[model samples]
Each structure stands twice: as structure tokens, then as C-alpha cells.
Target: ISLIKKEIETFISSYNKSLQQKDKNIKISDIKIQKNTLSLNINSQGIFRPHNALLQLKNSISKEFGKKHKLGVREIKINNYDIQFDLEKKPLKNVTIPFADVKFKEKQATISLNNIDEEFLQKNYIDRMINLVNEKVENQYYEGKGEFWKLIWESGEKKPIWTKDPTEEMTKLDWLKQGPTKGKWFFRPQATAILKTMEKIAVEEVLKPLRFQEIIESNLVPFDIWLKTGHLEGMPGEFYYISEPATRDVEKWERFVDLIKITKEVPLEELEKNISTPAAGICYAQCPVIYWSFKGKTISEKSLPVLVYDNTAVSGRYESGGRHGIERVDEFHR
Candidate 1:
């Protein structure tokens, strides 16, 4: 880690010197190394310029590390950046009117609003909503001259326009350089927006009716209790520990695990089953979960169906592969 940090710092110095030649006012404030991943905090005079610099830095780091390390921009703070243009807030065009095609048998025919099919209503509503969203997103983030959104690839090519379904040509084209993989899915802004929009649609149109609620919870959970509950079945006992340094002290590690197990009263067999290694035992001190939920028993049939949504960070271990990217990482938000 120290050696990697030094290499990163040296690269940053050279990168900054190059930027000076180009009259670019961007510099790395700090470089944080976490295992094999690098997080860089940057300061720049413009918003987009910092992103460009980050991409360059990532590419440089990837070349330096030779595919063993992953790099990410932890944060970018623009010193004097300002939004110079406004998104034209125009009314939606081609709005679809629900039930507009309904035919009346007679001049005085009437229909109840409730009589509309739920499936039809939902489909139409979501279609119209998605259309409006797409229009807004396109207008604000269109890729062309005089557009509000401007993104350049690491290869100095203009990014293609955002599409509902990116074509083979578009997908093959290079756009961003912030991930282990280099393809359409690695374009952070577009990919993140697409995922978020899909999740929103699922929650609002699909899962919402199924009694699932969007929830906000911490990713960290009691490790022993987590194990006792049989949450990490089948998978190996691999975890990212928050209090890892304390585990080096034998007494503290034992006391920590003992305290959690005693508090939760986890069965001895279950504890043994979960904590297979010293690392796993120490990781039980601070385990990360994507999400969790529990409901109290109620004797009413109305409460028979209980649903929950857990969205949080999860950690896992994986062997190295060329296909690995943001999708498959040691720590990721589900």
C-alpha cells in the first residue's frame, strides 16, 4: 500500500506538471490508498475540467499498476466553477392522454374512472412518465454543440447522445475512463442515471404495489447476529472489517467477539460455523450489509404479508478477472 501510494504521488506530480503546460488549473489535493484501490480528492478551477483530469489520472494509474489496482475519484471540488447556462424548462410535448381512444356507443355514454383497467392505467402512466423524464434528461444532457451537458472521452472524442437503448456502435465507443472495464456500462453518469431511473420506475410502478417501501439504513450491522441469522449461507466467510487494527491485540479481539456473541446469545455451533478464520472473527466486529429488515409477529391476517427493501453497501471477496468492473467489486452499494 505504501509503495502504491508513493507511485500514485509521483504520478500526480508528473500529471500536474503536464497540466501546467496545458494551462489547466487542476491538482490532486490528496491520494488515499485503500488496499488495491485508490481514491483521489482533486481541486480544480472548473467542474468539467476536474472530471477530465480525473479520467487522465485513472488511465495513468491503470498503466502504472498494470491491471492489479483499481482507481476512483473520491471527490472533486471546483474552486471557482459556476453553472454558466440554464436548462430551458419547457412544457412536455406529445403527452399521452389516458383513455383518449375510448369509443362511446352513444352520445350520452359515460364511464367511471375506477372502471379503467389497473394494468392499462399503470402501463400508460409509466410510459408517459418515462417519456417526460427522457425528454428532460435529453434536453439537459444532450451531446452536441451548445448543449448543457458536455462529456469527453479519454481518447478526446465527443460522447454520443444518451439513448434508451444504446446501439452496438455506441456501446463499443469509448466514453469514460473511471472503471476497471472500458465499455458503455462504465460511463458513470449515464449508467448511474439509468440504474437510478430503473430503480425509481420499479419502486413507483412495480414494487410499490407489492408493499415494498424505499428505506434508508446504515450498511453496518452486528456481525455475530448477522451470522446467527444465517444471512451469509453458502458464501465463504469473507468480510471487510472496520475495526481491523484492534484485532491484532489478542485480548481485544476475543473480548470483542465474546461481547457480541454474549449480547446476542448466538448458539456456540452457529458462532463456530460463521467464524472460520481469525479474519472472519475480527470482521464480525464490524460487518457491512446491503440491507436488513425484521417484523414483529401479529395475529391478524391483514399483517400476514410483510415486505421490506434494504439498500446498502455490501462487501465480498473475489478472485481477479479481466471482466471485473464497478459491478463486481470488493465493496459495492446494492
Candidate 2:
């Protein structure tokens, strides 16, 4: 793992020198390696074009590693790429609808629009739309089996509380105000319902007609199992041990820590010596990831490079006060 890290560092150093010659002030912010794949997260400054920079980086990496290794760029931020929406012409007392002006730099487009009363719509129609969408999704996709879809409820086990200790008492509403938990309860229900409706439409309406196989469900597995499979780790957020029972085996814990140290450059030696002490919750997990092309049965040379995807929630201990609505959470479902 360290050797891989050193190779990546060396590649970046060489790439930076090349970029310097081209008068570009950009560098990689982070690098995530899993198996033979490398994901480079870049940070750019001063008129950097993401598409062009990515092409250059890919070329450099190809020159260094050849075709044996896979490389990708993640989270490329382009400066000053802004879009503006505006009303082109005002409506004359409901006689005519206004036109919307969509502008992106020198490019511009216009479209017809209708302005609706938000308060009246919310008071009269929002609930009805929500119910209709929910009903459609429940019957069509879930076959009216609501049990399969868990509602975000006030579970005392997962609630966010104000107290430093878990034993301390707090009101449900008070706990919600602490972070994005409020959004999970208030907004996620409607958002998830709408999302499910779209997904159902795509699968049933679109993909089924095209005869594509539908694998439209999530998997629930143990945390250790997820770690062992190398599905999630080492991008962001702090590590957390949910329960002693889940992580009580000292030998297994040490092995997991050492694996992370090798892959993620974490200081496992210090962490192992101070096992009983907390270290700002920075520890992460490392697992051996089986590539999609190699999963299950062996394939012939003619059937090469199969695609696979794994989507599920994974646990993390995020820094306190880092929560932003449902965008960032302790357990992210993606």
C-alpha cells in the first residue's frame, strides 16, 4: 500500500512540474486508491479548465503506468462556471405569462413560464401531490408493502441529542435541531417518495421496454462485512465504532487498523498503543475489493471488462458541526 502511495506521490510531483511549465497552478487535493484503481481529487486555481486539465492528467498517468492500471479524476472544481435565470418580460396582470431568460456566459435562451402562488399551492395542493406520488409508488413499485421502505422516524437509538453522553436525556425536537436530522425527518420522506417514483418509472416504463435487467434494491450487511469487502473508506469523515460487541475482538481490530494504515497512511502504531484512548475519531478501514470483471464465476477472454455496481449505506463518525441537511450524515445511503 505504501509503495502504491509513493508511486502516486511521484506521479503527482511529475505532473505538477509539467503543469508548472504550462503556467497552470493546480494540484491534487486528495488521492484514493482501491485495488488497482486510483481516484485523484483535484483542486484548481486561476482560470483552470477542468475538462482540459483532466485530459492532461490522464495522459500523464497513462504515460507513467501504461494500460495496466486504471486512473480517474474525481471532484474537479471549475471556477466561474455560473448559470443565471431571470425574467425576460413581466406579465401584465395574468394576461400573459413571462418568459424566462437562461444565461450561461455569452450564451442565452428564453422559455415561457407561469408563476404560481406558493402559499396557496402549499396549503391546497402540496399534500395532495405528495399523497398521490406516494400511493403510486407504494402500489406500483412496492406492491403496497410499506414495510420494505423504512420511514425516517424518531428512533431513540439513532436520534441526535444535545448531551455529550448517550445516557443523558433530551427531547426529540431538541435532538433534531442539532444537525441534518431535522432534514431527514422533515424532507427525506417526500424526497425519497419522489425519487422512488422516478426510479419506478425508469425501470417499469423505460428499462423494461428495452429489456434491460432490473436489479432495483438495496442490501443490508454488517459493518465488518462491508469493511472486509473494501466497499467504503478513506475519502472523508471520521471512523466510528458503533458498539463494543461489533468491534470487541482485539486481534481483528488490530488487523483492521493495520490494513487501514497501509492503504490510507493512518498511524496505526500510535493508535494500537493507545487502544483505550480516543484519537479524534480519525481511524478508517481497509478491505480487499473484488473488481466487477472478476466477481462470481470466471469468464472467457472474449467476455472482458464486465461492469458492476454496489450501492448501500455505510457508517462513519463525522466531525461535530459538519452536518449540512441530508447531504452529509453519519450513515450515507448512495
Candidate 3:
């Protein structure tokens, strides 16, 4: 019994080390040992499904004791009482991923200002041009990119009858590197009585921080931000981009900081049964460990998207079935 206990201790030590390496918040809190029965308790910062962890434990026990008890006579009970994830927001830094879009509007209103002795007409025309420019800019933002047009007025006037230098807010054009145009101009004279302006800048910035916030908040997509460790069974984003063979390969992981929709949870039991299938292969090992049981019960699920199995992504683990998790030391007790 002592030898078996020592063996178990060694294995436990290694297992605990791997879990720690993954930064899994779970820890071995209690252990009950006996001749044929053993129970291990762990605390974690929440899991997608507690039962998945239970199943992994079950498999580990069976695999460990299979040499002597092929029938899988070992039982396991893993409890996660109060697990909380430290999902605090980080500092805001500039990112090149174009998370936001910028739209700038420029207006150039030009009139001959010749043979016209009226100021209201000129003012009205300039105002109208400004409105036109604003309209064009707003439309472009919604309708994609277009020419950053300009309207210039020229006449017999020595200085080419001009209105107040319209463009006041000179947005460092370079700042908007992705902008459609850096400049545009048009020159004409009908002697309407209005004047022209050099440049009038109107810009709008749209930033999408919680891209997935709308879906979750409106319940349009049933998804949650898992700041801890676990798996997301089903997400609506899966259907957006389908894959060959099945949906597993097509499914994309929308992480804790992603925006997604919760469609349903994938049947983990079915996945376990068919570990060799292509779909399973895609979704398998999604996390270092899966949470399946909540207080020792099961729930009917449909789909899953995000999985938190590993805090660190290893180069290659699938080809070895986590053999890296095991180390055989030269120590035998018989």
C-alpha cells in the first residue's frame, strides 16, 4: 500500500506541475487515499464545464490502474467550489490591427462673387456647400471610400473671390494613413454671388471595443466572456465561416477578448466516443482540461466555441497524446 501511495504521489506531483505550468488556477486541496478508492479535490477559477474535468480524472485513473485492473475499478471525485478568474482589463496601447475606422469630410465652396452685391446669397451658398460636404463625408463612411472632393470658386476678382478659409480643423492627414484621399480640388465660376473656401475638415472616429458585446447583451447570441479556463461549446460565429467534413474544422475560437455568439454546446460525450473523427480532431485538446460537471451533474448542451485548456500553446502535443505530461524515472518498487 505504501509503495502504491508513493507511486501515486509521484504521479500527482508531476500532474500538479503541469497544471501549474499552464497557469491553471486549480490546485489540489484535499486527497483521500484507501486500498481501492481514492478521491482528489481541486479548486479552480471557474471552468466551462466541471464534468469535463471529472471525465479527464476518470480517464487518468483508468489509464493509471489499467495494468492491474483492466476493468477500470478506480473512482474519482473532483470538486471546484468557489473558483474566480482574474479577468481584469489591461492597459490601452496602440494596435495596428485597425480596430477602428476613421472618416474625414472636406468641403470646398466657390462662387464668382462677381456681378452680385448680396451677402445673404453668398452666406447661404457657403452654408449649403458645407452641408453638402458633411453629407458626402457621412455617406462615404457608411458606403465605403470615395473621392475627398473639393469645390473652388474663381472669377475676375484679383484674389479669385474667396470666402473665409473654410477648412479650419486640419487633421494631420498623415495620421489617417488608411484614408482614401489626402486631397481633392475643383475650380469653376458662375458668378452666383457666394465665395469659396480652401478646406473644411469633418472627421468621425468609430472604435469597436466590445465587438461581441452587442450579441451577448441583446441575447442575439448566447455567449459569455470566459476570463478563466474552460471551453465554449457552441458559437454562432461557427456558421459564418463553414469548413469541410463538419463544423468543427470550420469553427473559429473567439477568445475572452473576442465578440461571438453562443449557439449551443458540442456533445463532449459524443466527441469522447469518437476521438478519431476529423471533427473531434479539430475540437479535441481544445484546452488542457475540460470542465464537464457542475456539482456532479450533467446538462444538455448543443455547441461550444472557446476552450481554455492551456495557458501556453505548445508547439506539438497532438501527435503525442500528452505524452509530454509523463516522465518515466529510473525507480522501480516491486
Candidate 4:
């Protein structure tokens, strides 16, 4: 028993060190061998899932303790660690107080009303309610799309025209509908020719005349880039995240391919459990990646303003609602 405990402790220390090196916020809080099972209690930071971490650890354990060993991982328990919030900032305070007997579990806190003034609290509470109402009204007004159009154009003050007429000529444009998703579509020869013509006109007549130099850029932007640009902070759920496969584990890839071939169905939940953490976010806009090119460099006076464009840039965005047509799609070329 002593020898087993020593070996376990050494393995745990090495595993914890590896996790630290990888900057993962997970560690085995406790481990015990009962009968033939090896139970591990994982303590992770707030909201951090240990799926990938545990997967790697399991692989490590399998290699360390041979495949024939009787050790099996049945449960993975996560205990929440206390998070400290700044009280001086006067964060959102809940007004409702339960009348029933409140039983505090692992963590306990005491709220004292003795020093707080009743009249002052009431006044602030009313003020908070008013502010909340004002905020909601403002949000609704801004978020709600209003009828607006650009009437004035370069060719004098001409108004845009639209029609919903059902004609054979117009209906023929809808030749392709074999897109994998609702917002994506496959353009047939007819539609493709028209699209190519429009692209040529837009480039030759509009962009080329303006001396816009086209440049090709990657569709994937590192997660850290978005953080530095403050876009992720503004719209946390707007962009699709990209994850890489466990390329080092060749057997895992083979197993996945075999599973797909046999089942003819994707095991998304299983894949999610085993896949690595997202390394980058899909390009939400072309401009963000363009800025990345100028990183770690100084601009001279001669290069006052950089003029560049990317016709081949494909952007992806996760829209929560208000999707009408192909104009607003999950993936689009700008």
C-alpha cells in the first residue's frame, strides 16, 4: 500500500506539472484506489471543463499502468473553488431574500442589515429599478432594426429599386438548393455566370479604379488576437471557434475514422468530449486580420495609410437570430 501511494504521488506530481506547463486550469485534487477502480477528483477553476485534460491523463495512465491493468476511471468529480468579487464596486445585489430557513453548504456568507440604513437602501433600490428600465428601453431601441436606406449615390440622388415578381427568368436563378445549411447555397451555371460578371464589374469598374490592392488572408484568427482587439469582449458568442485534432495520437484518429465508416453517423457528443481546446476563432471580419499584418512593426511617414483589400476573404459569424436570406449567412465572402 505504501509503495502504491508513493508511485501515485509521483505520477500526480508529474501530471500536475504537465498541466501547469500547458496552462490548463485543472489538477487532480484527490486520488484513491478502491478495489479495482482508480478514482480521481479533479478541481478546476470556475466553469473550466476537464474533458480534454482528463482524456490526455487517461492516455498517460494507460501507457504508465499497462493496458491489462484492472484500473478503471468511473467518475470524475469537480469541486467549485471560491471566486472573489470586488465588493467596493457595488456589484448587482439581489433584492429577494428567502423567508425559508437558508442552509449554507460548503461556502458560507453572512449578510448584515444592522449597519445599512433602511431609507437609504429603499431609495437606492428604486433608483436601480429606474436605471434597469432605462437600460432595457435603450437596448430595445438600438437592437430593433428600423427602416433606413441609402438614397443618395454617386450617380445623383437615385433611389434603390426592389421587386418580388414571380417570373421564369427570376425563378431560374434559384437553380441550386443543395446547400448543407439554410444560409448556404450552391450556385448553378446560370447563377454562377451572373455572379462572375458582377464580381468582374465590381473589381474592374469600382475597386481597380480606386487603386485597391488585393491581398489574400487566412480565415482563422488566433483567439488571443480577438482578445487584444476587444471584439471577443464586446460580442462573446458571435464568432465560431476553431479547434485542432489530436494529431499526435494517430490511433485516436484511426478509431474516429473507423467509427464514422461503421456507424455512418457523426458522434458529435463523443468528439466534443475528446477534442482539444479551441486554438483560434473563425474570421468574423476581414479588417481584423488585415491589422494583424502590421503587428510588431513601425509605420513610416511615407506609408501614412495602408490601402489593402481581400476579395477572397471568407468570414464566419454565429447569428443568434434575425436570419432572413443568404445576405446574412454563417459563412460569407467579403
Question: For all the candidates, what are their Cα RMSDs to the real structure?
Answer: 30.2, 23.5, 32.4, 16.2
Model 2 per-residue lDDT tens digits across residues 1-334: 3446778778777776676677566666466666655556554554553335656676676676655455433323322222122222332212211122222222222222233332423343433333333333333444445565668876467655654532122223233233344213232354556556876786678766765542322222334444445444433245554322334667857766776768887665645554453322222321222232244777888865433323332334454666554455554443
Candidate with better lDDT, 3 vs 4: 4
Question: Which is superior by TM-score, 2 or 4?
Answer: 4
On the 0 to 100 scale, the lDDT of residue 68 in model 1 is 66
Model 4: residue 51 alpha-carbon error in angstroms: 35
Tens digits of lDDT, candidate 4, 38-99: 55665566344344556567667657765545443444343332222122222222322221
Those runs of model 4 whose alpha carbons end farther than 4 Å from true positions after fitting are: 1-162, 165-174
Top lDDT prediction, candidate number: 4
Greater lDDT among 2 and 4 belongs to 4
Candidate 3 at residue 248, lDDT? 42
Worst 10 residues of 2 by lDDT: 91-100
Q: Can you tell me which runs of candidate 2 are displaced by over 4 Å? A: 1-189, 201-297, 301-322
Preferred candidate (lDDT higher): 1 or 4:
4
Candidate 3 CA-lDDT value: 0.34
Q: Looking at candidate 4, what is the lDDT of residue 211?
A: 80
Query: Over the full model, what C-alpha lDDT does candidate 4 score relative to the true structure?
Result: 0.61
**The best candidate in terms of TM-score:** 4
Each model's total of backbone clashes? 0, 0, 28, 0
> lDDT per residue, candidate 3, 206-231, as tens digits?
11221211110110111222113322
- Model 3: which ten-residue window has the lowest total lDDT? 213-222
